[model samples]
Target: MHPSFTRRHLLSASSAGFGMLALQGLFGAQSPLVTRRTHFPSKAKRVIFLFMQGGPSQVDTFDFKPALTKQHGKPVAKDSPTVFYQSPWAFKPRGQSGMLVSDLLPNIARHADDLCVINSMHTDHNAHPQAILQMNTGSFAFTRPSVGAWCVYGLGTENQNLPGFITINPEFSGGGPLKHGNAFLPAACGGTPIGHGGGGSATAPEKPLKGIELPFMKNARLKTEEQRRQLDLVQTLNRQKLAADGSNEALEGLITSAELAFNMQREMPDVMDVTKENAATQEMYGIGDGKPTDQIGRACLMARRFCEAGVRFVQVNHSFWDDHSDIFKGHPQHALETDQPVGALLTDLKQRGLLEDTLVLWGGEFGRPPLLNKNNGRDHNNVGFTMWMAGGGVKPGIRYGSTDETGARAEQDKVHLHDLHATMLHLLGLNHEQLTYRYAGRDFRLTDVYGEVKHGLIA
Candidate 1:
């Protein structure tokens, strides 16, 4: 047998495997804090996404359809597939711009001039899991890095002591962590979740982030200085192993995670602590007001603090909007729970001067159909919906695009989910096409192979 064919020799000869490992290690070591330049001059410095988990009926909320109301309880034709159900709420022009807004969101309606309502927004899917996935990651059929992950990967983090991206009170269903996951990107780019927004309970249970406090320190077993010294030793040993192994992504992640945890222990607690705010500030968010607004208010307030601290992307999730029955009851409850907090977030951001550079996005996965479906409620409608954006370089007080006269489909200036993703990246100064990640021998992006920036939405 050739000497090189010996078991020991053959094992040593597998240098290509080692090379691949080393290459992975090199990529893994890429820091999430290394800021990169945008493709062009951009308007927004960061983004805050107020994600309404289930679909909210646009016709009942922002898109008022007089034609539909006129035809209420009437069939489109003798053979029409669905029955027409007009919205229960009243629509009135708000602000100086005379933007018509439904009374369902009175608090939000107060800031009509700050909103850029896109009534012709549509997506690829009609279901929650796929539609939500498509809305967050821009792909419903495949696992992909989320928009937040892409943002972190492209722009890097401003604060090394804190996570670049955060999702507050995210629910476990409808794509769950996948909606905030990094996928093929570096693990560090994934969002740090504050609390799981429970399964649309009347009150979402509050849980602190796991590992937010070091067990040893929490138990008083190790002092801060002592832990630092121990961490240094552990990191040193990991580095030595990395040198011997030629490269190890897991080891690199371990080292990075350890360092981040230590720093977070030192700094993150204060940022997460909403009690630090004054009574008036807390009251403004309805923190102790004993209403549905309290839960989302806390979340919105925390989001503001995170944004002020330079977090790149912060998503505050409000859920259970999938009202297939009792939308009259469901929509009102959701609006009451979210409207005040959302409106407060915008008002606070503007007051703190963060509004101009902080892009705020508010919408659900899709929207409800114009016609009634099961038990006097609307069905999932991906053909046309409504979404709104504020600040972040978008033209304010403008209503772009339109659904049909019956508010059933996008008939003018349709903005697909891909287009929304592209426009979001554009606002953040990233070219959706140019923001590419090499994975599985192919270059992938948030927008996949299709995206066009909605130029008219820009200021």
Candidate 2:
């Protein structure tokens, strides 16, 4: 079962990249284990959802708050409707568009041209865990099929050798697996987590994407053809059982899942390897090296690779943006960890001609308040938050929605998360109104009867 030393060396070394060519030559386009096909023509066949967990401070990050700086540490002109705490943080322009971003994100500032930042965004839940679920899945408290799951069910898979939905160690905090779980939907719709440490949403300086582990079954040295034969037998048996016994739906799903896993063993590692990348590319991704705070640089880099390999959806999360303690210490750390790499990913996609068909989204469940907390940090502000989208059918340099004087509320062009989701689905060419899943005798959808596509974001 031990891997050959040569194979091990290749697996560990990412720069050679010849492993992918080798795998393709040996297995063809189909899974070296099992290949799956897509259901429809797609404008955006893949997604990279950068989840800023713990609701980032929109006013401090992207949404400018000139008034907040003017009124810093002072009470509002009006009474405190929600809390006694007043607004916090200052904002200024970062990049050519003159779009304001905070001081925390210098690295991201370098690539501002590539980002499409949405100023006004919000959700129902203000709490961390519930809002995380609401953002990832569609509800506040319920365990439903995550967006990743729905895409898999709606479009099936373009590359069956790899998982249809891959979550590289999603946060386990508030929503945890709920952010990527497939509740009522088949288990197949749930995300295939690449690493074990991601559920924590930490940004330490280790391998940000090192925990990618395959099923124990894939640890062997058998020829891929041998596994394919075994899978074919299982698939045939399952088909007959479905035909004879009316339908063992779950078991049938298991059959498909198994075949998918077997195929993934031969393909997934190659996509994850970074050693084979040229030094310039590696520097761009910050894979082996980046500032301590921007630990998520590698995930951003890998997202591009997955999109290239035809993955339908990839959600990259860097959470704990909830800065209820110290905004000075908190905001900068998260930004440094993410900014440059995100910029690099967007640019790379554009250069590679993948941006036209790839959708990249950035944001959190909600945003922080302009008002200050006891420790100088801002609290969650679901009333008016922020999010942004790019590539796919998105209109470049377009701004949608606005916040009030203190950057405390959504004042103009209010775009809710549901609306954001609808617009994303619209860009992918699927009618949000038409894409529905029947559950509990009711038709359910990601938008959930409450969304209007933000036209300004469209190309």
Candidate 3:
């Protein structure tokens, strides 16, 4: 191969398995993995990040503020800003623990006790994109590796069958791949974003959202036997190439990626086969059976499938929540789209014994500011927000930290984004400070410069 072509192949192959497949000329030198990796052996082999993007109004979601509702139509403080919007709906207690949740998310309310609600979350950046980056990648300006990417790096992957991290239906409204990118790490560590929204993308929900078809056994095109031979030949070639270039870490990486894709072709479809799910399971995830945007429902179900299949991390985006204008329309629809399936994924995983080590994160980049705006909507608040964690060493029926009485800022037992990232890494048996990638003669880490595990939240 020409020297330039060889260099391009390295980039193209670096993403899809460590490096194992032959070039098809379609993916065209782009990486299949963009999220970072974990730093060590992991208690949770996989993660399903159920991001309620656009900063859902916490008062209307899992973070209950009775004071807000009690003082609705009037400011709790005389100096209260004019921008805070009141929730249109009343929240009621749900589930055995009776955690207060708005009626808009009744499905989610059913799982309240199982949630480890962290109400004292705060970020340095408040805008959607910056806060999102801070939440996912641990930085607002610098392009650091995302939490998913860092996890993959720290722990490698449980299943080579799927990419280390995958995002379903990420969109501009939700801040796109910046919401999931793996910066400064190898290209192999980034998230593979699957779609634009609930639907409409070549690789997303409306179109075979489970995964790109594997290297062989196509539903169309090449037959099974032919496909097998192709994989076998490719493996043989890679083996010979490795023998010739022993200790060539870059080449070995390429071989790993392609080989993984070949093996996954056979395993992923079955693991992700919703068709095999009985009607009861389907009903639990809210897939089909007349639900609107069942596409979002399907994505959440696939996240469960991927985790069960041993994929390291999966993100299912429900971004439409930037309610700059309309809370009644925005928050409810967003709630309707994600609430049941997420609750179901948690329930199903627990039923299957997967919850013990499979960590699940829910909530958004930040939260709505407390004061009401003239437009009847809320602005972003990095001062205080809520995010929850379940399973993977998280305590059950627990509430960690607390906001000041008004719930406007993190005061007691606050969990910063870096601390949250560190705590997550710690649960996976990683020393967040030790898991560093050397770049530009400096050691880079996910929780750069600051982090401490919130041990109280650990199970």
TM-scores for every predicted model:
0.89, 0.83, 0.81
Candidate 3's C-alpha lDDT? Answer: 0.70
Error at 353, model 1, angstroms: 0.4
Instruction: Arrange candidates, best lDDT first.
Output: 1, 3, 2
Which candidate leads in TM-score?
1
Model 1 local distance difference test score: 0.81
Between candidates 2 and 3, the lDDT winner: 3
Once fitted onto the true fold, the runs of candidate 2 whose alpha carbons sit more than 4 angstroms away are 1-43, 76-96, 196-217, 221-223, 289-294
- C-alpha lDDT of residue 100 in model 3: 70
- Better candidate number, 1 or 3, judged by TM-score: 1
Task: Report the lDDT tens digits of candidate 2 across residue range 328-393.
Answer: 777777776677778788778888999888888988898888777557677878989878877787
lDDT of 1 by residue, 174-200 (tens): 788899998877677788876642112
Candidate 3 Cα errors over 4 Å, as ranges: 1-43, 69-71, 75-86, 172-175, 196-253
Rank candidates by TM-score, best first.
Answer: 1, 2, 3
Over 11-113, each residue of candidate 3 has an lDDT whose tens digit, in order, gives 4454544533343231222333322344444567678888877788776676666666555667546765463335667778766777677787777677778
Q: Evaluate residue 262 in candidate 2 and report its C-alpha lDDT on the 0 to 100 scale.
A: 78
